[model samples]
Target: MELTLTDDQQELRRGARRFLAAESSPDKVDAAMKTERGYDPATWQRICEELGWPALTIPEAYEGIGLGPRELYPLMEEMGRHVACAPFFSTVCLGVNALLCAGTEAQKQAHLPAIAAGERTATVAYTEPSGRWDASAIKATATRHGDGYVLRGHKRYVLDGHSADLLVVAARAPGSTGENGVSLFVVPATTAGVTRTWLPTMDQTRKQADVVLDGVRVPADAVMGEPGAGWAPLARTLALAVTALAAEQVGGAEACLELAVEYAKVRKQFGRPIGSFQAIKHKCADMLLLVESARSAALYASLLAAEAVEALGAGGPSAGASAAFAEAASSAKAYCSEAYFHCAGESIQIHGGIGFTWEHPAHLYFKRARSSQTLLGSPAYHRERVASLMDL
Candidate 1:
């Protein structure tokens, strides 16, 4: 696979960085994070209207831009570096991916246009209070009743759930058992008996919610795919999410390295620049190595995912092909997670006491790094998945 980006891809990267630098300045991000909604509606609208970002990866048949992960990875990197407080991650990376992976023609027709137009915000509700990332760990149930299903149970750590108009939920359907029985359903957030409460998070820039579906009922058609057969699609969606997140981690790591180097060149101790000190120089070198390594891993994983999608066509990939993409995704996620946190910590160290303050963006990167490391799965969890894929 080619590691170098094409001219069009490089142009996309440059445009993204320029746009984010102007629109997502640190002060704006801080203000948005401090608010209850955690993002500016006007800014989000502009992104959709001017940049057409939300449609970047959705298929054109659904009125989307029909781009692939190659375009998405660069945009995610820019967003991460800017610590952008937007719904892109939840709405595009998780929600849109779920629809692409599992949504039938009718379902895609119903949802994708609204999403591509940025008229509706959506998120996937997967993890429960158990906090396990495995499909079999789902305890939320959708019990059949007449012509529909009644959903009961809570979903935690739902990204953008509090503001999302649509929720793609994973639940255990009646008459099915274990992971095999798990199915995906689309529920309106305003549906009766549904409660969304924002959670206190360390990374305020990216908010999460606790969603309770207390006997919320929906039509049988709410199911995304065949009943009791949602695991494969969900798994594929998660592989895309992992690769998306890895790209973000690489961006964050690069930002951390930049922050450290810029500070070290200016901050002085004992009548000399601290960057001249062997210890600080070594730290910056290590951060650069980490950032570049993570970037390559993330980029390669994204390419693999996009290629797999192309090879398998829209009907969905074969089991072996899907597993191969999943392995690459898991490897990238594992390495990038640790690398981001490491770079963030070193950036803080290089910045001294200022890094700990709330006013400084260093703390923001640090918190985001810590939270993102465990979002889809912890580094250790992905490592375990990688080992399993290797038959270790």
Candidate 2:
């Protein structure tokens, strides 16, 4: 089957490219990365308020654009291209997706509109110090306490956690293990006993934090969906987010290819542009192939995710369909992760010594590549996941 963007989608991509170039230029991105919040507040405001980015996937009733996952392709790719620093990933990808997947209608009414309005920022605090994204990695406890729940856990590697206005925390019952008793809670970031600490990371363009919930208490309404049945929604959320992330990886890989080719053409060696050399030529060709392959994988997976979302609205899908969607997600995640990292590393190699310097943009992309490879799940982990889904 042939897949091509509609004219509207193409326009959206062009518009996004223009906006990112103007707002997240190389110099501006460099400056933004050094900030405590990892982005300019005004720029973020423009993204949320002016561009209505946070509302792209929100339902129409919630004052949003009501677009599906496929619509997010352009914006995510643009963010990856510029490596723009913002809470969009945490707020839109993690937070919004978490709510959309698991949230009750009441919960959606309470939170999503604020996000759509750009008045709130949120993220999913799912990973722990164990550095795992699976339900088995969730060791936090949520105990009943007078019509509410008291949560105790320390979440590490929470994207944009330190600054988000809200957090959707995943934890299990006191005696539960793995997927059993898993539940999600929406807690205000300023709630008592909730402490957030920013952790320094290799990719400063993306901010992560350590969030400790020490006996944090929230009302019963904070519970998203049915208690002890959060695993399915969370899994879907991860699948969707990772597919979007794969799209971002494609854009980053493309950027690496362009950067390498640009340098190969301008940087002279042996009295000629190094791009003229067979070795450099081969590397650029390989990078191009990786980028193209990654883009195809990302787009196909994204369309599957869009179908999954539509399925959710129509009372969910059958077991077989869910498995198929999961398989595609794992495939895209695995291939895109490796492709981006490979392209980034090749770009750095093509730039030679200058690429390793702090002043050069090549190193930034390289670091992001390394960090993203292990974010949702390592490429190896996704491969295993795919195999399991295939029952191989």
Candidate 3:
């Protein structure tokens, strides 16, 4: 497929860059990170109500702009470059994607409009304390009770969980086993028996929460897709998640490379710019290669993900095409995660002692790189998935 950015995509990139530069500067990010909410709600509202960023991928039928990942990727890249402290990813990418991929029409009608209107923040509750990413590893249980279901379990590393208005949860339903037992549910975060606790994060800009659902009850209609069949939709949603994250990683890597190159050009050592030196030049060259290659992989994966979303559209995909998209997602996630971390480390090295200080934005990107390496799943995890998809 063509990995080149179209005219409209380039415009999106420029608009996003301009907006984020003004609104999400390093100073602003630092201040927000120190706050209880981790991001300014007013700024988020501006992004949604004014820029319509949160509506990028939501369907128009739900009062959204009705775009896809092809349009969303460049915006994600811009957000990554600025380390934007917003719930855009967790809400738009993770939560919205899960709903669109699995939620019934009634469910989407209920939540998507609120989300698109900037009235609600959303996140998915999937990972447990065990930290396993597979559906079969889910331990949260949903038991049938009267005309509803009672949920009892804890989900860890839930992005934006503390403030999210809606929580899309994955839990094991009674009378099913293994992957088939896992079911997706739409739970209001403020519902009785639901408790949220903020987690200590390496990257304060991206807050994660521990959500406990202790005997929380919901109507049977809370189920997203068909009962005993959540794994398929969740898996597809995760593939899209990894693809979107890869795009972000590539963007961050590109930003780190830019910072290093700029610093090397002006930071003189021994009466000459460090960039003039062979060692520094080689480091920059290597970083450039890593960033460009990762960008290509991320872009291609994004295209495939968008196409997959369009083609599948809740009904699921043909086996071969699904396998192909899964492989692309795994490859992009594995390579981009490692590439971003490498570039971040190299940027620090090129900046010497100054980059190591907390004052520099370099450290923020470094921390983000480290934390994101395992946010959805580690590079090793994605690599293993790639192997499985390839039948290696």
Whole-model Cα lDDT of every candidate shown, in order: 0.91, 0.91, 0.91
Model 3 spans with C-alpha error above 4 angstroms: 174-177
TM-score of each: 0.98, 0.98, 0.98
Weakest 10 consecutive residues of candidate 2 by summed lDDT: 1-10
Query: Could you tally the backbone clashes for each prediction?
Result: 0, 0, 0
> At residue 331, what lDDT does model 2 achieve?
95
Q: List the residue pairs that clash in candidate 2.
A: none
Q: Per-residue lDDT of 1-392 in model 1, one digit per residue for the tens? A: 78768899899989999999988998999999998778999999999989999999888888899899988998999989999999999999999989888887788899999999989888999999988898777899989999999999999999999999999999997656667888899898999999999988889999999999999999999999898899878988889999999999999999999999999999999999999999999999999999999989999899988987686465556778777888999999999999999999999999999998988899889989999999999999999998898889
| lDDT tens readout by residue for model 3, 1-392 | 79988999999999999999999999999999998789998899899989999888998999999889899899989988999999999999899999998899899999999999999889999999988787767989999899989999999999999989999999987656678878899999999999999988888989999999999999999999887789989998899988999999999999999999999999999999999999999999999999999999999999888889888766667799889899998899899999999999999999999999989999999999998899889999988999988888
**With candidate 2 superimposed using the best TM-score fit, by how many Å does residue 124's alpha carbon deviate from the native?**
0.2
Question: Cα RMSD (Å) per model?
Answer: 1.1, 0.9, 1.1
> Model 1 off-target regions past 4 Å?
174-177, 312-314
- Supply the global lDDT for candidate 1: 0.91
